[model samples]
Target: MRLLVIEDEAPMRTALVETLKAEGYRVLAAEDGISGLELACTEPFDLALLDVMMPGLDGFALCRELRKRGKTMPVLMLTAKGQVDDRVEGLDSGADDYLVKPFSLRELLARVRALLRRKEREHALGNELSIGDAVIDFGRNMLHRNHKDQPISSKEAGMLRLLASHPGETVSREKFLDVVWGYNAYPSTRTVDNFIAALRTKLEKDPSKPVHLITVRGVGYRLEP
Candidate 1:
C-alpha cells in the first residue's frame, strides 16, 4: 500500500522512508506541514504518518485542514508530547491513532497494520453513494458536489456510509461510537455528536436545520438521503 510520511526531522524522515520501503510499501515523504499538506491533498495514499510539532502549520492545524479538504485516509500522529491533552487534541483533530515518540519500530508496524485492516473493513461496505446533491467516493474518501470536491476522513466516511446503508433508520449513539471509533475510544458521547455536526455541515443544505442528517432526539441519527 502507499504511505505518506510527513516529518521535519531529517534522520527520522529518512528512517521512516527506508523502513516503510523495506516493508514493501510505496512511500512518500515531506519535510514540513505545508509540503505534506500539498502532497496529501493531491496524492492517493492508504495511510499517513504526521509529526505533531513542526516549524509552521503544526500537525493539529494540518490535520483539521485535511478533514476540511476531505482526505479521509487513516492518520497515525507521531508526537513527543505524550500528554493526555495532546493525545486528545490529536484524536479530536481527526487523527485515527497516535504513537508517542521513541516508539519501537515493531509497535509502529503493528499499529499501521491494525489501522489498514480497519480501513479494509470499512471500504468493503460500499463505494459510491449519494446524499442530497453530494456524491461520496468511498474508495477515495472524497465528497463530490456540483463541480467541487473535498476529501473526508475515513471515520467520517465509515459513519456516513453506515447511516446511508440504513436509510431512514435511527442508529443509536452507542452503535455509532462502538462501530466507528471502536470499543476503547475516548469517553463521552460528545465525540459522536461532534462528528455528526461535521457531517451536517457537509451533507445538509443548512447545517443549522439539517435535512439529510436528522437527529432523533434521544436516540441517535437517521439518514434520509
Candidate 2:
C-alpha cells in the first residue's frame, strides 16, 4: 500500500518512512504540511499520517481540506496533544484516527494495519449494494427502490458500510460512534439507533421487524447480508 507521512520533525519523519518501508509499504514523506498537502492532492495514496502541528498548515486544517477536495483515503493524525478536546478536534476535522506523540512504533503500526483492513473491507463492499428491493449506489450517494432514486447521506452510507463490513457480527453502539461519528462525539448511543432505523426504512421490506439489519437486544446490531 502507498502511505504518506507528513511530519515537521526530521527524526520522526525518517523513522516512520523507514519503518513503513520495512513493512513492505511504499511511502512518501514531507517535511511540512504545505508540501504534504501538495503531495496529497497530486498523488494517489492509500493512507496519510499527518502531524497536527506544522509550520505551513496544521494537520486539522489539512485534513479538512483533503475532505473538501474529495480525498477519501483514511487519515491518521499524529499529535503531541493528548487531550480529549484535541482528539475530538482531530477526528472532527476528518481524521480517521489519532496518535499522540511519544507513542510506541508497535502501536502506530497496529493502528495503520487496522485502518488498512477497514479500507479493504470497504473496497470489498464495492460501490453498489443490494438490500431487499433496494439497490444502493454508494459511488453516487443514491439509493434506488420502488422505481425512485433516493439520496443517501454520507453518514448513512458509512454506517451501512461498517455493518456490511462485518456481516453477522454484532457491532456495538460504541463501535459505531468511534467509526462513524468519531469517538465520543455524540452524547447518546440513541443516535446510532436513529440512523439504523432510517436505514431499515430504506433497506428492509418491513422496518418494524427488520430481517436483514438485525438488532441485538441490550447489545448492538448485525447485518445478515
Candidate 3:
C-alpha cells in the first residue's frame, strides 16, 4: 500500500515515514500543506495523513479542495486540538478520520489498516482487468499470463494499478509522476516515458504497436484493457 504524510514537523514526519516503511508501505511526505495538497491530488495513495495546522492551505482547506477535485481517497486529519468541536469541524470538512496530537503509534497504525481494508473491500468487486495476455490480480498483486506468474517490480505494479483503474481514460503526465514516482520532484517527462516503455515491453504483444497501453501524443497515456 502507498501512503502520504503531510506534516510540517520534521521529526514527526520522519518518524511516521520510518514507521510506515517498517510496516511495508511505500510512503511519500511533504513539509507543508501546499505541497501536501498537490501530492494528495496528483498521487494515487491509499490514504493521506494530513496535519490540521500548516503554513499554507491548512488541513481543512486541503480536505475541502480534495473533495472538490473529486478525490475519494481516505484522509486522516492529525490535529493538536482534541476538542469535540475541532473533531466535528475536521469531519465536516471531509476527513475520513481524525487523530489528535500525541497519539500512540500503534493506534495510528490500526486506524490506517482499518481505512485501507475498507478501501480494499470497496474496490474488490470491480471488473476484472487484463492487459494483453496478462491478468492482473489486484488483491494479490500478482500477474498471471497463460497460468504462469510474471515477476514485476513494485514501481511497475503501482503503475499498472493506476492504469488499470482507469482503463480507456487518459492519465495525465503529472498524475503519473505524482502517483508512480511518489512525488513531484522529477525534472523531466522522460521518466514517465521510460516507464511506459517498460510497461509496454512487459504487457504488450508488440511493444512498438501497443494495443492495450496507448500513448496520446502531446497528452499522456491510456490503457484500453
Q: Which of candidates 1 and 3 is the stronger one according to TM-score?
A: 1
Sorted on TM-score, highest at the top, how do the candidates line up? 2, 1, 3
Report every candidate's CA lDDT.
0.85, 0.89, 0.79
Query: What TM-score would each prediction reach against the true structure?
Result: 0.63, 0.85, 0.56
- C-alpha positional error of residue 51 in candidate 2 after TM-score superposition, expressed in Å: 1.2
Worst lDDT window (10 residues) for model 3? 177-186
Q: Rank the candidates by lDDT, best first.
A: 2, 1, 3
145-209: candidate 2 lDDT, tens digit per residue: 99999998767888888987877799998998777754565567998999999988888888998
Q: What's the lDDT for candidate 2?
A: 0.89
* C-alpha positional error of residue 27 in candidate 2 after TM-score superposition, expressed in Å: 1.1
What is the per-residue lDDT of model 3 for residues 1-225, given as tens digits with 9 covering 90 to 100? Answer: 899999999999999999999999999999998998788777798899999989878999988888778777878888898776777677667676788889999989988887786567547635345776888665455678777877665456657777766767898888776555433434677778888898787778889999988899988999887
Q: Which parts of model 1 are misplaced by more than 4 Å?
A: 127-225
**Which prediction has more favorable TM-score, 2 or 3?**
2
Measured by TM-score, the strongest candidate is: 2
